[model samples]
Target: MSTTKTYRIILSGGGTGGHIYPAIAIANELKQRFPDAKFLFVGAKDRMEMDKVPQAGYEIEGLWISGIQRELTLKNLSFPFKLISSLFNARKIINRFKPDVVIGTGGFASGPLLQVATSKGIPSLIQEQNSYPGITNKLLSKKANKICVAYDGLERFFPENKIIKTGNPVRQGLLDIDTKRTQAQTFFELDKDKKTLFVLGGSLGARRINELIEKELDFIIGHNMQIIWQCGKLYFDQYKIYNNTKHVQVHAFVNNMDYAYAASDIVISRAGASSVSELCIVGKPVIFIPSPNVAEDHQTKNAMAIVNEKAALLIHESDLEVDFENNFGQLMASAEKQNELSQNIKKLALVNATKQIADEVEKLLKK
Candidate 1:
């Protein structure tokens, strides 16, 4: 009788929840397929992933690594030292772990780890979750055996032969949100008769988005609309004062994300890759206020991808002060417009993204 072989895998990515969660989702799907696979995660030390990965039931190792801030600072001076240390640490991990496959989602830790893995001739894949690739992923693309992307035309950055347009992995549960609307309304104690607006700005929160909600609370309430506002963890207290009011509810984080999506007739969101993917699946009319602070201005690029398709509206952070009320009010007043955006965005949803990414890994494993 043949004994089953244990496949070893090395997955590296982190920093924000955007990178961490997709790496976790891909790992989860791979685990389902290779039940006996041994997995190890490499993330930047002190990053949220160190805690989040273990919470997701995986063992992880940390590299002494971080990104170089665009603006000059002391951290920029330390980047070379950090990169050297990370590369050395990465070599040690690869030699010790001896992974059959190395996978990188976009993050600072991924660069050194995947670079070291390729030097050793190990099979490697990268998952780029935006229309525009990040500096790390763009640099690593040359050696990657497969580049799984969430948008088309990234061949401008990656080798066309290596590109695979696999959409970002969103929470699988979000696919069934329509079935949860009634339960979500009940859970939030919202009136069944009022239209609900879901506002999301990602986990740490967005100052501009929080401020917009604060300024428009009365306007929304007066228009007979209810709100499920996820102001993010940072600004929760600052904005929590508006909660439980007649038509407003403020949350630091919405743990039951599917319910939040289900309860909404429309959404106001930041266009992070994971949020964009999930919002596509949620199929709600959305106004995307992309954060300007990200690398490569990728958030704006992400939102534009959808807007180009006429699937959603794009409001820059700079323009939100002038455009927020008018853009939102237009969507609110027109059911026909809302339906158009909803249907068009849903057409871009790749509900099987995790599985497709897993399939790419499976192919690499077979080689």
Candidate 2:
């Protein structure tokens, strides 16, 4: 908590926004608490974090590391070599940087970095964003001094004593969306009179979600609603044609997520941990389509946590065709349903997650 003590901290996480943004949020909070702190980020080479971390105004070092492929492939063959190389590089970085505390937010890069850090007897903490922990976080949990988690019941994957239910750190920008509603509508050039539907397919995009939206645009528009669709960069080229249509705007990536959340009435989103956290804070009626391609089918578990609370709806990719229209129609037809969901989900928001995680880090720094 002392602004004068210069604490060197290394935050590592990447490969997805779910991993990357939480690290950034934590770092941002810590920086505010310790204005003179020295910060460095470690992420996997060629991963999005290499660019994103620097963009968030921190220096980052990249390790020659990547996650192993689930299926047998040439990539899997090189896993051993990559792991060895990354471990060597992570050691060199740790020795040179001499961080007071290293933090991992769950990513392939965090595996090597945290492994080396813990072996050197340095204090380390990891943040697990999902209800179920990732392989990297699970492995790091053995040696990590603390495990900060967003969901309950994570003690099944982590040491019960080390686990803290601090919730996921959401971006500061998203915390005050209600104040930005009119400004967001103007920023997005949305008609104030029309209700908006926001579609998110995660950072890399979802093929099935895109297909469903493309196929059902008529049905959605027939309800007299406008749309702000983030189709992800991969699918933007294919879905950009919809931008020409009335009452619809398509984007590859939404830089202004606060505006995106504020300008929308209902949301259709993927069930990535970060997205779910943000959606909970945004407090919108949501329909979640969890990706089945993840390591442990964790996205479904994340969505089900909310759906079980009656805070949101879930439509698996397999059931989208049969259930999406009916579910969406009912939601759209009932304003009371929307308000109920919005109010219920809002109750679940852990708005102080970033500060609490920083408080934990401050504890580690003092030790």
> Which candidate has the highest lDDT of all?
2
Q: Please list the residue runs of candidate 2 whose C-alpha ends up more than 4 Å from where it truly belongs after superposition.
A: 1-3
lDDT of each: 0.90, 0.92
Tens-digit per-residue lDDT, 297-318, candidate 1: 9899889889999999999888
TM-score of 1: 0.95
The backbone clash count of each candidate, in order, is 0, 0
Candidate 1 wrong stretches, greater than 4 Å: none
* Reference-based TM-score of each model: 0.95, 0.97
Root-mean-square deviation of each candidate, in angstroms?
Answer: 1.7, 1.6
Model 1 residue 330 CA deviation (Å) reads 1.6
What's the residue-level lDDT of 144 in candidate 1? 92
